[model samples]
Target chain A: MGREDKAMVKKAEAATGADNRPFLFRRHDAGTIREAYRKMLLIRAFEEGAENAYMRGLVHGTMHLSIGQEASAVGVGLALRDDDQITSTHRGHGHSIAKGAEVKRMFAEFFGKETGYCRGRGGSMHIADVSKGNLGANGIVGGGIPIAVGAALSARRLGNGKVVVCFFGDGANNEGAFHEALNMAAIWKLPVVFVCENNGYGMSTSQARATASATIAERAGAYAMPGRTIDGNDLSAVAEATEDAVSRARNGEGPSLIELKTYRWRGHSKSDRNRYRTKEEIDHWMTENDPVKRIEADLVAFGILDEAGLDAVRASVAEEIEAGIAFAKESPSPDPADLERFVYTEGA
Target chain B: MDQPVRELSYAEAIREAMAIALERDERVVVMGEDIGVYGGAFQVTGDLIERFGPDRIIDTPISELGGAGIAVGAAVTGLRPIFEFQFSDFATLAMEQIVNQAAKMRFMLGGSVSVPVVMRFPAGSGTGAAAQHSQSLEAWFGHVPGLKVVQPTTPEDAKGLLLAALEDPDPVMIFEHKLLYKTRGPVPEGAYTTPIGKAEIRRKGRDVTVVATGVMVSRALEAANELAAEGIEVEVIDLRTVRPIDTPAIVESVIRTHRLCIVHEAVKTLGIGAEISARIAESEAFDYLDAPIVRLGGAETPIPYNPDLEKAAVPQVPGIVAALRDLATGRR
Candidate 1:
């Protein structure tokens, strides 16, 4: 191995926490880790800006933020092929950004402008980039799971060898679509990876109150597929598990169920009064298990980035997020005459 | 020298349409419970599995919501998936995928993509399958905006409409009458499409127009034949597609006949017939009507398991004849 690789491995090994689990940040080189860190921070900043926009009455309807679940989103995107497809849930901004959605267009969508990804029709919950293989963010709970299976079926039938990653929540695991999709993927041996981001709450209902299973991953056994639960806050762990699952799907082993144990830092939506959970609990996850800070510590321990470098990264990302909002503010609104469009294919 | 036409059953015609579509396009696939080896609940997909193999003719587990969602997903992404429900009544289990996802995906996404999905439901009451196995819910699908609901009565229209539905860019629901599957008619030899959104005049007369759908089309024609013997001419209009309810054709017919009688196997309250009656009354045909528009529909009750009750629940030839005679004779 190269000297830099050896040094990173040594530093990653030495960067283990008091819990004694080997920090495997060495899975990616320092450069890639740095890039992943930037992407996660971009998601965090963009979500914060969106929340502000909603507060300022600039956004329509409501927006579901993934402020605390950045690692799970970015890590899954890192494991996927550039041309690979994904079906996301309502809480899907991070997935869209990580899958390469243009922040300006996303902001335009939230602003309900014509230049948005869906031409302003689908706001926060329904934003999609077919070109990037982000099928769309579904409003219905567990709605996108079967869609991912169908996309996987398309890949298998078309001989594209592309894997489809399906992102849902712990509550979605209880949905019948989840069970049916997993069974179909298992029997058909379709290349799909089902990622359940267990954010510990299903719209204010605690996971304990809603779910009967100890862990969502255990339910994969019922479908006869491999399942795993990982520390979603740890970027290295999330990436490693997702890479393993993606490779398994590409190798024609059917689907793997992955449960990312994460937490959402914000309320479910703009209307949430935060009555479901305690402030102490949110602070505990935000401080001890923050994905961004964990990666910062690893970068600092490995000597790849210093406090100044981290500050620069945050500043650049913040500038980019502000520029995206500005672009969306200047974009045009859709013509009212076009309101009746898309009911059916125009020419077909 | 001339070619001779051969008679084919409605089920056989539908199977032929699917077979032709599978042969024509590699992207076309059919899925449902027991659709492969068991040839579907009504044997409409017989021999398709052997002909096209399991990959094209998929047999799914009994999960309506999942199967429908998968088909919706597949349709949006470059595949013409024809999903079959074993019975129409079970569609209630899949309303979320059909009504919410498939119906709204294109509009909600601002026309970014088209979902070319076809769903086949074995509808209507005739078999001894009782209430759960029987229903005529075409109106339910017709009420949805993005969905196109078609009910093909004859073998010819069965093959034609199924093929046409496959060609449609949006989701199309095909309500194949369970009782009509065995009925035989002269179907064309090759691929053809009965145009959607157009009504066909089954039998022409000038006194009154009998607008009907699915099994009621044949019942209306039979009623027309009986009324013709009674020296009363009844125009029989077969409404092949219900959503794009051929109002112009119905209006023109009502204007010519000066009377209207609508029939459907679904219940009378707010059924497809009600829409047809409303359209006729709201149009210029209302001024020309010599009698009040009549709606002959199924009784307001679940189809019972008893053969006699089941037969009495929906409109029959006798009922259509009686209704049309009353309208023709101006007896309200």
Candidate 2:
């Protein structure tokens, strides 16, 4: 369907059908689901802590929190192997978390400590851990699209059985780079999945006003590629859709654009004053489709661990975050002489 | 030994060089906005796609920022990308990729990778394309670290400079003037890489040392002949590579002639001439200066559309002659 028909179809399904449920697995493990739930909680706790620190004038520079969009990050990140690469957006704490960044180092980075990933040089928008295949969290809108295309091109040319998952917002789809990168990836059959985390806004402007289409994924048809949108709040649905895209890319089927219908919990940045969005809208999602709460209730209903286990996970994650803050606080700043150090190769 | 063909223009020399490079190196790809099927803005890369196919000769979207960033990413992944900016003026759009990213990658990665990328721009003002299209921004890049900057005046230098840039394990910016493309000169056939960070003495004389760059090299030669009629000998040096400058060439010529005049197409204030003047002033050649070192560059104003006004904006044949005359007579 065209993008215009997508939301209408979704609304009609919401009114008529029973809530979509997956078939119960005969051999699904409770530990695995619990671990995923724990990760989502940690991401929430970590991002909320960062937002509080930013307000108290402790964290330097700006931050983009992914509090409300935990399931999309955990779902897709869980589906990929260690060697597969992924490019993230500015609101990318959850993406980094899924790629397995230490909570302490992330806190250290936000604190501008030398022990951070970028040596504290790159702030929130530029965090990177290439060892984990997180290329980076890009600052410019639609910036990561082209870089991910290059990575996919390299992987395809080298015959490396790796696929790249490129995460961009709805606003990025409006950029020319998105279309250019998607078209190139399509024609070349590059091993890439264009993951559009279509959270409502692309910064101040609403997605409806900025984009002509109803959804970013439907626009992928013009490139003659498969496009699908999943309930980004549903971990199982997101994981299945993403796994399909990654597997297709690895099997030499070119690229696929998947739109994860998610939302950001906090303001666009640290200093958001809630001028554009309302508390009522925030309350609606917080009460109904909160990813962490839904997954927690689902696990509980399935006879997984009880409230005691969840509380223990929270305590341990909090202590780890505190240690990371301490580590960053105790870490030394880079010397002034080091500023002129890395500008060029000293010699051949 | 016989030369391969007749005289070729500087622009044609560049095209031949790119064709040879693309033919020889599979990793070499040419990318720009209108370069692929459109034949480029100046036709320097005319019909390359027909020869090399679209994979190697790519016509990128009009997003210079995105194109440049993609080139940087491709370079890091072991591709030799030859990026073309339609005009030097449009380079402002891609400066972030060139200045911050391309120039900083090697160092940041702890020398793990090399940015073997070449960027070509149609620099200088001769084709009355007005302010937005015509500009000379090479000096801005030459001042930056980790970049090898070049400005070739003749066809021979064009071929040699591009070949040299392709071989170097660094990012190189080549400023080819719009006027010098049709200006033909002898160019050897096949592939040859000139040594970068070096200068060539284009003309020889004694009384005054005239250090010129880009288009100014030919103008300086014309001025030397005019000065020769007045019994004033002048030596001309073409600074092929502007950065990591060949200070020894300028200092040696200055020591012999005892007078130095630095000329360029950029504005006089804080231009490459100013840097050359500083180097000469600080070097041992300071004592040998019989007259104060002179700098002749673009005027401190926008490039005018009027042909005469445009000529007055930068160093002309007469400006070099007058500067040489004053220097030879030991006058400021």
Candidate 3:
């Protein structure tokens, strides 16, 4: 291993202390910890596969890859039930995987096949699996924020014990929808958690340049809600923050805002030239603050899994991703004649 | 024995429809600005909060975009939300939610979901409320593919169509003329639905077909009465729904009359008239046209504050009479 990698591992071990129990180990059993690891690995592998497919000209259009933000997605997902809802953003493959979506259907959607989540109509920007409580991944900035508020309103009115988690990027924090949705959710005391994955940049416009507030979470105070900012690379921090927010929502105590300070390892989209940021900055985040390595380090320090066990997890995730891609490649293309079928409800 | 139908104003008819919907379904909710204790800006939702309470008849803050989006989300999640825009002109502020979200949600989700949202707009220009408040922009919503746009002219239709919109599995935009609120008509008691996309023939004549929508339907009828005295009988067809327009009814009317005159309160250029005219020209009715189709609509300007100018901006009864007379005669 490289000296820098070894130093990061030693630092992670030192943070665990003599008892050697990470924050995740304190809250969850070994099984849940392993599952979280699998989900995060699955997200990374799925996006890597999607990236490869895009490079090979197998996928059309562009996609926003959430490569280094797996911990935030899987961490938030670990705190909620299967029935609890989420409204995702454009960089939503990780969120989808963490929320229990079948990778094959997601791949089929990316491939524009008939068996896809949106029947190949929505493609990557609008993947939705409502049955599993993913309302949708919106193309418009801050589009899904109000929708999540509405879903929470329905949950409150119906007396259903469901909480909605809304996921967005640092860019969406500036949108009027974000403020309006947060204000309404607060006044109505709706059950919702707003998770902002602040990956530093919004399509090359850094949050420092775009946002007025020092921290995105501080804006939540204006809406009369609790807000917190934490290191997103730490999976335990994300899980703990989400658990608190979800508990408050489920208890009818209203919404909370959590700012996950992380970084993206890829460009915003396929067409993005690396002109906005320097290579040294990207390399710093990739090597020092990688979410996958942090989790692996925590697991290893706590003795949840040995090196061979970690390799086994990686191999299994790789196999699942390959299988999902193959299923997408073999899926049938939708008939052109049925283009207008889902435009409106039948017999309405 | 048939139950006696009682006379009710357009506003009362709309309120009765909401009351019935709330009573029948637990999922139905009514939300808008000043719609609770204040009873709406136009007083259309009078005393509804007392009966249904604040939870069902929600009074939202002055956030059109946010309120509209919340309604879309609520509808997608299984709540039947009836969202009211204070004025039809306010829809411009919430177009993103209406066009991109509510209209496209089902298609984007591959039909796994449906947004059963009903938005009511108090439309048209008779009131002194100038440019912003007075607009008959039903044509705008009609132009959209996924939306069902309807203009209910009478008290009976106002109640019936509102009920029908609640039952629809997709978003329905109802443009209610503000001036028609006080107009009374026979409205049947209890739950009843008027079929959307069906134009009703108010008065059938053999001379010329007068196609009109919203408040213009009543004006067309008045013009028909005035023209009948001069031996120029005019047929008045109330185009209740604009989108998914009753093309068959219009084609049949044009075929019988051999002449057509389209009237609307919106601006004439690229308005609903243009769409109707193009449809007739493409259909079998085109062969039967004796005179070129005449269109009488609003002037190409924002509604003015002056009472006379406001009246002159849109097609009044006198304007409809003159247009129909021109079409019936050889004059262009």
Candidate 4:
């Protein structure tokens, strides 16, 4: 509304160019770096448990596991302030955990427990804890992208000084809403970050088969915003890229599109046969680009802790998971009469 | 208060209503394509952007998906965002946002939220806008579960219906006919709210009940006047709200009159008349019926580019009168 902000809005559109350049990373504290690692491990463990529970019919819906992709969720989430919001994908348990949503309640939701994030209303793909600023994962492919842009626009309108990060897949980039939302964000210079998790495939369709372009991040130039492709498997690289983008957004520099180069190690969903991907494809990421292992290696290289100390954190996290399971087991299913609740976030 | 009962244009009535709403509630915000300084393509929101400023009167980008979604978001987040679609046809772009997200969010979230959003769509045919811009798709939202549909006939009803829509806790789709903007009548001087999902009998008679929606109400009344000259008395009902439809009113009128004719600008198949006729046939009103319901609606075709072709596509006053003549004389 101010003259200064209006001038910057004009300059923001003119800032975008045809240049394809690399964005470098900055160093972070050892504690912050390790926290990202433990969080990824926790996400992996929780989802692994969910996959097993779902197979046993303990959980009802199809589970979209973030088994292979964690660093992107953790790195970007760590860069966001407490008030900053994020919209995630079906493969979003990691995003939720990374954004500081309660793990016990998330597990409870999967188990149809009364103590779940949505009180058992939303299962695996719809875990939303708005109080923690996680806008919840969407069922549709590109559904939540526009919502994130809208949220950022609201922040900008009220001058709330809060940024919104929207997380979607490479498949979503093909959606009209994606382009429209990104263009609106760019035109308004709203504080929004568009994160494209290019995990090789969109459901059963490979990105190569579905997309005309070679790289998804390159398409961001059409929307006239800064775009980057990072080593999504490398925790340090993702963390650094996220910091730069988050800082730019906070400074009223509009939105940034980041393509995190990673792959889904498990099947796309619980029922996925994963025949579209070769075994070699899965093995290479498992052996070389494992995020937890990368961080564990750094933890030892810095002489901060030995294997025993790290083992204790894992054990403690596992204990918390067991208690969550117990809580989920005790949690009751929602009554049929309570069906008409919480559709809107207001006075429902 | 005794105000002059002069005829007013539909667009001017909408503008006057918006002025009153802005005067009534500070929480109300108007957002849509060209609704800002552009004053809207139809000029329904004339000069509102200048008077209310950007915060209250927003000029959103040409992204209907984002515009409607944000309006829904703002509505749920404690702001009453009255969205305007430049043309009713553009609603197809925001169907998922309106039907799936805004409409069902209340029920899906277990009644924990209230989508107090009013979507003002410049609907129906008259501008020769061709297929893309000229459409009357009210039946689409009316069929949805968690939404309310309103279509006003007179200027006073337009004011009343919009005020009521702004106050509802659910999403209300207000279908404004493109040709009805200039039709004027007695509008109250001060603040008031019309009861939604309620019908008003514009005229009382005995021979037949002619229930119409939106612009067809005026057309039906005209047909009734000509029919009165032919010694066939007809009652006209204006169904203000399409969803949670004023069925009891229509059934009551039909039971007394023993004949019914439903009229609308939309196509005959799956139109509001189809549903209302089915309701009449299934309900207790079936026992009192003297004739099978006659439904006069638009022909099945895209609104053509040629003005003549376009005019032939939808219902006209002559068409309404012909339908009424057939119903009174036992002709098909």
Candidate 5:
């Protein structure tokens, strides 16, 4: 590891304290931390399995994998209740898993099977489990922002006390929908948290090249909302920031923006060639700043789990991914005769 | 004994329908720009804010795209939002939400959710609002699948259709003509639903079938009255719904009259008239045609600002009379 990388890791370790108990332990139990670790592993394993399936010609079309940004999804998800809703983006596999979507059904969706979340109608870009409070992932940039605000509006008017989290990439910050949605949520004091997962680059273009503001979180000031930027690789930092934001929203204090600074180890999509970034930069993040590795180290250092316990977690995740793929493979495709079944509400 | 007759302007009927929906369903909300104390651009939502209060009758900022999307999101999450576009032409700004999100939400989510949202568009020309404000874009929404598009000609249907749209589980787009807001007609009190996708035969005859929508329905009726004195009988059918069009009614009318003339305020090139004509040509009504189907619609240009030019642009009573006369007399 480079000198700068070693120093950064040391600083992160110092934040956990001299005894090595994770700072997150103050707020979360060992069981909760372990579950978070398991979810992070599941997200990584799910993406890898999906990537392998794509390579083997088992999956059609392209997918935007959140291979390195698992912590942001899990952290925010950890702060939300099962009934609290979220609107995800194109690169939303991690968010879906974090929000309690079944890996089997997600795989079934990827395989275009009828057992999929969207019953094969919506593939990678549109997976949703509304019963679980996931509105659905959107293909359009900043598309889900306004939808999330609307969900908050529903929560307020219906007196449901349910908060909504809107997840988007740094690219979406430039979209007018984002600005407008934030403003409306603030004016109405709707319960919603705007989570911007700034993973350095939007496709090939860097955030510095695309955005006018210094930071995506800073843009939240224009909407008169609280904003924060944190180390997304650090699970404790991400969870804490999201918890604060989610609490603010639940208290009817309006929306808050939490920008998670992270990076993606893989190309933007399956089609990207990684021409815009350097091999050294990608290698740096992969080896030194991997979210899964960071959490596993913390789990070990904090005595939350031993090496054997970590191995068991990994083994279970692998089995789950294998079974998910198998289930999707065995599932049936939708019938051609019922092509127009879901176009409109039947009998309406 | 007959029910007590009550007359109401098109605007009052729409307001009453919204009031009924608000009273019947706690989830119903009416939102738009200047819809509160400002009373909307055309006064269609007049005094609704006082009746329903600001929470239910919201005055959204001039953010058509965001407002429309918020309504869609609200609808998906259990609130029935009735969004009003200040002008029909402004829908272009919010097409992404209406077409991509609202229309496709249920289908994309595999029927797990339904967007029970209604969008009201104050449309048509003749108000001197110029090209931008005056447009009959019902055909635009009609072309989209998963959307229910309706046009109400009279005060009664305006109230009935709005109420029916609220009950529908899918998204419905209602296009209200700007000029017809002041036009009064008998409307019943209380809640009642006019069935969507059904055509009302406004006037019946056996010569030529004049199928019209929106303001064109009134002009067609006027033409039918004028042509009756000249021994030319014209049957006028008001096409209330544009998307799941009342095909059976049009086919039956055409089979009886043996002649068809479709009229609309939208451009004739690819308007609702084209769709109706195509449906008749493809259906069993084709064989019953005694003459070639005629379509009298707006000219191929934006609505002009001048009163004379604007009147000439769309199908007026004179234009309808001329087209109906030509078709019924075997001249065309």
Candidate 6:
């Protein structure tokens, strides 16, 4: 191997640390890796912007920010086809943006503007874009699991070779809908991948206290499906694992459960007081296991691009997000005359 | 000229509706527990698996939450899924998906997607299924904004309404009375849709107007016959859909008869009768009523296992006859 390639391997090892999880390039090429990095950066910048908006009272309601779980969010996008379907959780801005939702419309939703995906009726929690294959981002925890199963069933019934990725949090594992959905998906051999973003804490309760199993993926055996847990902060690790699951689903091997072991850099929402975990613990994860920084380090170590290229990606993402916010600000609010228009398919 | 219609049981009519839907649209599928090989708890989906195979006639696990959620998901994603609850009472288990997710998705999502799902519940008290399996929960579903609540009282309506509900672009709750499943009626062959929000007048009398739903419509017809012999003519109107109720029909009937009696198998308090009564009282029907509006509904208690007690709990032929007789005679 060349000196730069050897140096990249060493840097990947250093970044991965003692865990030594293999960084196999399954579906990600250099172009896709660069695109994945750009998407992850966009998600991070978008979340930071959402938080700033929430703080400034520009965002009307609270939102769950996947600030540190960018790799897990963007990795699935990079691994799957553009038309692959997904159902997201309340903490779904990162997933939505990574899955190719228009950032301006998402910002408009937060601003309660008429140009939003739901035309401002569904605020932060219920945003969705059906055309992009995002069934919706659910407000209810584990709500999208069954919906993803149904979407998979639809894809199969329609004879369209589409796979569904169901994104959920650690807390949703205990919900009845989760177990039911998994069992149904398993039995039907539905083309769905259950991607659990186990970010250590489900709101206030730590996973250690809330769950009996050491890892969420261990429960997959009960349903007779293949499952694994990997470092969600490592973009390559997430991509490798998700690529396998997506392939299995597309090949009609039924569903697979993948638990991305990651942490949330921000509080669950704006109201969270950070009383659940200590500042030291939060600081440790933020500095040591930041997903965005981990990928940046990998790109730098490979000598693929220097500081100038990385800075250019960051600057462009920031500019795009800022422009989205401006567009949202300029969008008009919904008219009062159309207040009761969308309650049903036809008027009730 | 009258069209020729075939006589079929209410259950057969429902099966025929599903079979026709499956044949016409490849997007349509039937899903529920024990609905495939077991042929459903009431045999409503018999021989369907043999014809359509297991893919189209899906038998779900005994998980209402999971099955209903899957149906909701499938519906929004462009599949016309007909989900049956073996018993209407089991709907309590699937309320989260039905009420929160399926019903609210369109409104909450600002009309971006439509959940064209049809959930069938074999409702009302008749069999020895007793309390757990014999509750009339149509009022509960009707109270929700996004749901279209309908109860088919005849075989013709059972077929026509089911087919029409499948055509709607929203979630529809179809409550088929368990007792009426065996009752044979003239059902039109081929594709047809019964208008959802219209009422049918089975018998037109000049003395008292009787508005009934589900099996009560049959009971009211029997009561009208008994009252006709006693010189008290009773008009019987079958209210097909409860949510988008035929209020104009009720008002018109009350104006002609000058008396009103609302009958249902659901509990008297806050039941569907209350809504109809309130609508009439708020409209022009109140000025035309010669007597007070009478609500002859089920007693406020759990449905008993004993046949006699179960029969007494709801408004029967005897109860409907008595209520209409009293209203016509001014004996209130």
Per-model TM-score versus the true fold: 0.95, 0.83, 0.97, 0.88, 0.97, 0.95
Model 4 deviation from the true structure expressed as Cα RMSD, one decimal place? 7.9
Clashes of each: 0, 1, 0, 20, 0, 0
| Candidate 3 Cα outliers beyond 4 Å, as residue runs | A1-20, B1-3
Docking class of 2: acceptable
Q: Score chain A of each prediction against the true chain A by TM-score and list the results.
A: 0.93, 0.90, 0.94, 0.90, 0.94, 0.93
lDDT of 2 by residue, B1-332 (tens): 25575688887899999999999987788889889778998889988889999888888777677677677666756678898998888889877778876786555433445778899989888777666777788889988988889988889889989988888778899988888878999889888877788899988888999899888888999999898999998999999888879999999999999999988887788889999999999999999989888898888988888887877788889878988898788667
lDDT of 6 by residue, B80-136 (tens): 999999999999999999998998899778898999999999998989888999999
Across A1-348, the per-residue lDDT of candidate 6 in tens digits comes to: 334665766677788774332353434456767778888889888888988988888877788888889999888887778788899999998888888998899999989999988899998898898888888889898888888999999989998899999999999999999999999999999999999999988889999999999999999998999989988988888888898899999999999999999989889998999998999998999998888787777777665556898999989999999999999999999999998777776543
lDDT of 4 at B154: 83
B1-332 per-residue lDDT for model 1 (tens digits): 12255799999999999999999999999999999999998999999999999998999999999999899988877789999999999899999899988988888777787889999999999898888998899999999988989999999889889999999999999999998999999988888889998999999999999889998888888889999999999999999999878899999998999999888999999999889988887898899989888888889899999999999999888778888888899888
Q: lDDT score, residue B146, model 2?
A: 82
Candidate 3 residue-wise lDDT, A1-348, digit = tens: 343564565677688764334468888999999999999999999999999999999999999999999999999999999999999999999999999998999999999998999989898999999999999999988889989999999999999899999999999999888888899999999999999999999999999899999999999989999999988989999999999999999999999999999989999999999899999999999998899998997787666888998999999999999999999999999999998988899989
Model 3, span B64-132: residue lDDT tens: 888999999999998999999999999998888899999898998788899999999999998999999
lDDT of 2 by residue, A1-348 (tens): 223353454466579884333321112367766677778988998897887788788877888899889999988886788888888888888888888888777777787766777676666776777778887777778777877887776676556788889999988999877887788778778899999988898777888899998888898899889999888998877888888899999999989999999888777886778688888888888878898887766555444667787788778878877776778778877666677554554552
Overall local distance difference test of candidate 6: 0.90
Candidate 3 shows a clash count of 0
Q: Is 1 or 2 the stronger prediction by lDDT?
A: 1
Cα lDDT for residue A149, candidate 5: 92
Model 2, residue pairs in steric clash: B266-B298
Q: What is the number of residue pairs that collide in model 1?
A: 0
Please compute DockQ, using alpha carbons, for every candidate against the native two-chain complex.
0.75, 0.28, 0.82, 0.27, 0.85, 0.75
lDDT of 5 by residue, B57-130 (tens): 98888888899999999999999999999999999999989999999989888889999999999999999988
Candidate 3 lDDT score relative to the true structure: 0.93
List of clashing residue pairs for candidate 1 = none
Interface RMSD of each: 1.0, 3.3, 0.7, 3.2, 0.6, 1.3
